[model samples]
Target: MRRTQLLAGSALLLIAAPVSAETLKDALLKAYNTNPTLTAERANVRAIDENVPIARADGRPALNLTGGYSEALLQGPGTNSINSPDRRTNADTQLTVPIFTGGAVRNSIRAAETRVDAGRFGLRGAESDLFTAVVGAYMDVIRDEAIVGLNTQNVRVLDVNLQASNDRFQVGDLTRTDVAQSQARLALARAQLQTAQARLISSRENYIRLVGDEPGVLDTPPPVPGTPAGVDQAVEVALQDNPSLLAAQRSRDATAFDINVARASRSPRVGVVLGAGYFNYLGSLGAGSGVDVGSQSGTTGTAGLSLTLPLFQGGRPAAQIRQAQARRSQSIEQVTEAERAVVANTRAAYAVWKSSEQVIASAETAVSANRLSLEGVRAENSVGNRTILDILNAEQELLNSQVTLVTARRDSYVARFALQAAMGRAEADDLGLEGGALYNPVTNYDRVKNRWSDRGRDVDPQPVATRTNESKPQGSEVTRPLDPILDTPVDRDAVNAPSKRP
Candidate 1:
């Protein structure tokens, strides 16, 4: 007996231990950790970082090493070759640093910087997308599970109605048709339960696909936060805070830099070059042998500045300038379109969220009313004043109302997050992801801009400079240093932006 008790206790413990629960916070963290798509986005961001250094390289000098070995035929008819017989080795090394490239160097650097900024904004946009996907998947599973619970309760209610019908029929209080009606309702309820179970299974699979593991069971969702003040408030938040919009803005900035880069190609480029050389030869002059540099100097060094003024380049520079200008125009339109989209989504999501709260409240009341009706009908049936059909109808109504309530509660919760997401304020921080990474506008931006500001540092960022509103301007041009993660827009300078604090 003691052994039996121990086995039963162990089995119960196992069942209890497996009943794990998950919440939205848990879902987002897991998605961030395990989702391959999000990881791919991060890799893309890192790849863009290299562009900053590439642009910076343009502003610096380029060094090359030249080496050659050759054997020469004697110009003379006899053993006397012009200098040496098939045995000469020459080596030269040159360092060419660009002192000036019209403004090409600076322009290229700016374009690169803008590209880095675009990439960072892209990172933020990616974060927002992943945030929504995780939340939606989480909500899908929770909603279906609630539906399953409601279906099970519906089956139970049908069972009670079926029992009542049989009791009434035996005493002639209910007819054959009434009994059949109750039986049919029970069958239908079972069918619905099966359907709800199937949906729940699919939902669970989708959740696990994104989160990398089965959530098993979800805890009850919390209530949505109170509504925002109005449509304007939601729209304002979305425009001010959305990463997507910032991405578009950065794209615009990049195009603007492109215009400058194209224009700079037309100016003169100046550079300095330093060279060193060595020449030696070893040969047999017919019967006479000689080993030496042959009276020629073995070491030499030269240094000078080279200026390359673009007189003409087949109209390519002009074409590039036109292309960049067109892109700038397109970027402007895209930014305008993106802003409109933000406002529309914010308003739509907020409307749904507010309406759901009211709907859920009303549904709760309806469920209570239906439950009261079911109880009253059962009492009437016992006294022969109500038929089995009436009681079964009231029970069905109660079940439906309960199911509606569950849906309302779920939708309301989902809409709250949706509104936040739509307004661009929805973040991992808002969802309480613990110890989340802060926005690193500087780290990503310096990947591009830091090269211009700090040339002495041994380590350099990427080819493209990442700029943000957070960067402060240097002068007439927006020679500001910026952090890449910043999304907030500011108008510190039109021609030159300054003091960017992300």
Candidate 2:
């Protein structure tokens, strides 16, 4: 009974050990939460968020404190010796506030806010890139693993063939040349298996670097996110949602505000200053000469307004305004370029995705046909109607077809992901991956935008009412349902049709 309990306990331990197969969603969530590159970009966004406060500081009040003490010896010409002591002490406080800057400060603040918005969009672009990269790595690992399996099976089959060929040669059914051919093919198969193993190792290392852990048996990837009906609709969606284009648009808006700021540099500035002071003179009477001092103290206060107009600045303000205008023009060109690129890329990805589906279907058919041919050839060889070389060749053809089918399937999935990414719909919510907290760039921005304290770091922003003034794409033309082909798994039996001839 004790031995039985020990065996049962061992079985329970084996079952309880954590060795769950990782999924594509797990890899994506791992990358999203732990990737150092993404984390660095998040920090960069937070740093950009500080610009708003820095700009607002130009329009806010500033206070300063001042204090000083000095001791001196005075000597004059009256019995004239160096024996006069004098001391002075003073303390002062001053406050200066900007009343106006001809709208420069306000425009600067606006520009900073726009830039912050641009940074947020930039972060979104980084996220898309990161998720895309994780997808690529995850798929690479899966692809290499399948290739390794195929290679291993190929080697095993070749080994068995080599042994059979040697036995046939001994029995006088096969010649020595045929046995040599089998041996050579087995050597090549083993080499191929080694190559596949190396590739699998490399892919696993990359997975570790990107996902922060070694890979496990990964589940098959699910269908990708938001799908468009056609290439035109995909391009349209990209134009509306692509983060890079949105960033450029915000940047253009910011540069326009910058032009206003540069022009404001030539306008008049108004400010108010308030000062209060306490002055004290310590008593030091005349000693050997005619040096005299008396104890005295007084407090004084002043308040005044000032204005300054820029009359001449060596044409600097004009040059600045011109520079700002040029930058605005450059940003506009950037937005145009970004739009063009998005349209071209979206169209290309959509075409690739559509083509991959066709490739998969055709490759599956080829595999099925080749499999039937292989079986028929083997049956003929069993009756001495076909040679061993013919059987080997048929097997090779079937293996090649299988490999091609696997590659086509992998490409189909990858292209679908690329299509989703090109349309800016490859985010966590769209993919239904709810593993961890989604890092919202706007959360950090809103948290730091109006911060006034310097004690602790800013807390993550709580959910607030949506801003109605937020910019949005206007008048979208296409709103079709997600394409069923891209959004649902293809029919497996159709993709893996049985050998009809067999």
Candidate 3:
């Protein structure tokens, strides 16, 4: 008996324990660490870093080796033609060191390095865009869940109203029309509940797709920090710090370097060439011939300076220079385009965030007034001064306002996050993601930019992102309950008291 009592007490404790909810920070951290799009962008930046080493190779020393062996198939016809050696083998090694290439190699290396910087900025922009999407998905689930709860509660309340209307009709106190009206409203509320549940399921699926796991109970997200004071401030900050704009500017600078690289092609190049050779007659030299050959093996070496001047390049160099100049011009215009887009996006996000704030305030007031109106309608119906339809309409108005309030809160939060993202302040570092050190693209660029070893290579890549295929299917469960204020009861005497109308 004591064991049974202890087991029962343990079960009770388990039931009372609260489940630890997932926070916005936790979700953002998961996305940051495992998102596939962001992972691919990091790889692309690493690839760009390799271009620097490739350009440097053009100015580095190169060595080559060649070897050949032959057994005379048929001795070249001719006597006194001192038949050539019946067997022969030879080997040669050469080294070429570039001394000058105008400025082609130098300017090409500079362009590649500049592009690496641009790629890193592009990676930052991708990170910020990903975080914004995650935030929107998170808020979507919260809003839809609340809407489902509200609709569920409405269905239950309407069902109760329908039963009461039926009771009144049986006693002849209410007409059959009154009972039918409650029945119709109840049906509509159930339909709305189904719609709300469907929307919630979609939101949960999207959350799983991004977060890499089925969402458990998600806590209310904390307010986004560091919102701009106004649209002008937001645009000012974005122009200075936005990743997209910075990347465009860097790309333009790199293109300017490309023009120099193209022009360098027209200049003279100089280099040094050194070579060594060995030959072996394989004991067959002068065999059976009256000629004596001393020592059938020999070695030789040579070194000299080489120069190349392009007298004419078939007009290729001129065309290349022109092409590069055109590209630079395009890049200049693109920088301006990026600036325009940043200003427009920042201002729009700011306006939406501000408007959402106003809508939230108005919705809160509407919810309060509608709740009081619902209570008054119920009191009037109890005294035969209001029809059943009046109560149904009041309930619906209250539900509308409640739903509006939920949606406005969601919009406000998401807009604020969007605003921050537009201003280049919504990356992992800005959010202070806690589990690990943030990925530093510069670490990779620095590692590979000057690499000289041919045998050097990074380890093979394994997937960093988690997969969600095996997780349980998402359901339409509501994580948050409807507001309790909706249930506040008003005194019948106060509701029925005559109003002092002006």
Candidate 4:
């Protein structure tokens, strides 16, 4: 069994270590450079780019060409007829471009541009989320590394204590109760060590899977910006940057355009046409009229416009307009609600972080106090001045304080990220960190979409941002190794740069 386990461990290590393998940054950058989601979103955004051309085409001249042949024969006619079966063929071409459409074309093009902006915001949001995910995974690896070290130190300390107690008992210097107490303490510590080790292993595995490879020492990011002057300011920034809100606004605008399009449908549409033709006359009432004469040709051109007015349609257009208005209203409500939600989250995270910051400091001090008390009790126990139970109680207090400090620190780190997220400001740039090759969906979109589109570039300038729900596993996010906020001051301007939201 021992041999089997040893072999398995060695195999895992071998798999983790690759020869000539890429650096962690290299690997992540490569994957980011070609991630399918980014590419997919970029294409979606660019598809929005075509609306301008389509709308403009509606206002441009339309030209068409037509040609046809016809043949007729009359048998046993009594007299030279003015009209007999006439063989005729006509070739014609006409061009008609709509010179105007009240507001349909302009409104449609404007709507498309607005939709593009929404996509840009959405893409920016997704970019921010990707950065957050990568950083969180990186942080998880760091946290696990720290915990493994801490657990190792704890197990060693417990082992030494147990050995010391055993030595004392061998000489009949320590009571059976003292020996038993040391053994029990050592066992508890060992259990904790095992649990910690398991967690570290699991965490490392999860990070590797998400990141696509084993992690190494990551370049530490600069500290986060301090809390803004107030929560309202933070909320304002979030409201402006949050892609979800922007998308909602875009939705409302598009619906207004839809109203224009629907209203225009009730109006008449006009255009122009030109043509040329050839004809053969088979019979004529005049005495000189010839039968089966050579075909004569004639050409003509004319400007004409065909209009379709919706006088009535069972109230369908009215119903459509009402539906569009309702959608616009719904979108407005969504934006308002989204803004409120962000504000509430920002406040909540701020409160929790502030409280945890103080608690972490206090807990560290408690751990120190408990450690000293446990030492004093142990010293007294050696001299038969303190009871074994009392020493054991002191040890428990020290352990509890350490555990509390660990939890508090973790909570503080998590809260900071949550706050940043609430503010719609969590991004790769926010970390002042960079990966090798960035995956840029826009560039990829241009390369793929430009091939068939004349104005592909104009279509999809918006960044794609995806919205997530509460169903996301919050605990999956990794805690940073240390609090940058507590360690170093961050630049406020750098932190609050204006642009698309993540």
lDDT of 2 by residue, 251-287 (tens): 9999988999999999999999999999775554343
lDDT for position 309 in model 2: 94
- Provide TM-scores for the models: 0.78, 0.81, 0.90, 0.69
Superposition error at 351 for model 2 (Å): 1.8
Model-by-model lDDT, in order?
Answer: 0.67, 0.72, 0.84, 0.58
| Model 1 global lDDT (CA atoms, 0 to 1) | 0.67
For residues 1-502, write the lDDT of model 4, one tens digit per residue.
Answer: 3234333432332222234433434534533444446556667776676565666677766556677766546547564444443455666676776755667777777777677677876776665555445555655555554454444444544555556566666766666887788778778877876776677666655555444455544444335565766667767776776666676677667777877877776667665544444444333223256444443445666656666666788998788778877877887787788677767877887787788899999987887777667667666555567655675576566656665666666566656666776666764445433655344445643445224344344463443332222222322222233322111111112111122222
Candidate 3: stretches off by over 4 Å: 1-19, 79-84, 483-502
Error of model 4, residue 349, in angstroms: 2.6
lDDT of 3 by residue, 1-502 (tens): 3234333432332222136888899999998888888988999998999999999999999888999999877655573223578888999999999999989999999999899989989999999999998999999998898788777667766766776677667766678898899899999999999999999998889888887877777887998999677899999999998998999999999998899899988998999999999999898887788678788889999999989999998999999999999999999999999999999989888988999999999998999999889887877777667777998999899999989988988998988998898899998889999997899998988898777888998899988888888988888866564455533333323222332332
Model 1 quality (TM-score)? 0.78
Residue pairs whose backbone atoms clash in candidate 2: none
| lDDT score, candidate 3, position 432 | 92
- The TM-score leader among the candidates is 3
TM-score of structure candidate 4: 0.69
Taking all chains together, the TM-score of candidate 3 against the true structure is: 0.90
Q: Candidate 2 — which residues are off by over 4 angstroms?
A: 1-19, 73-85, 284-295, 383-385, 453-502
Cand. 3 Cα-lDDT? 0.84
Task: Please identify which of the two predictions, 1 or 4, would achieve the higher lDDT against the true structure.
Answer: 1
Q: Is candidate 1 or candidate 3 better by lDDT?
A: 3
Where does the lowest 10-residue lDDT sum fall in candidate 3?
9-18
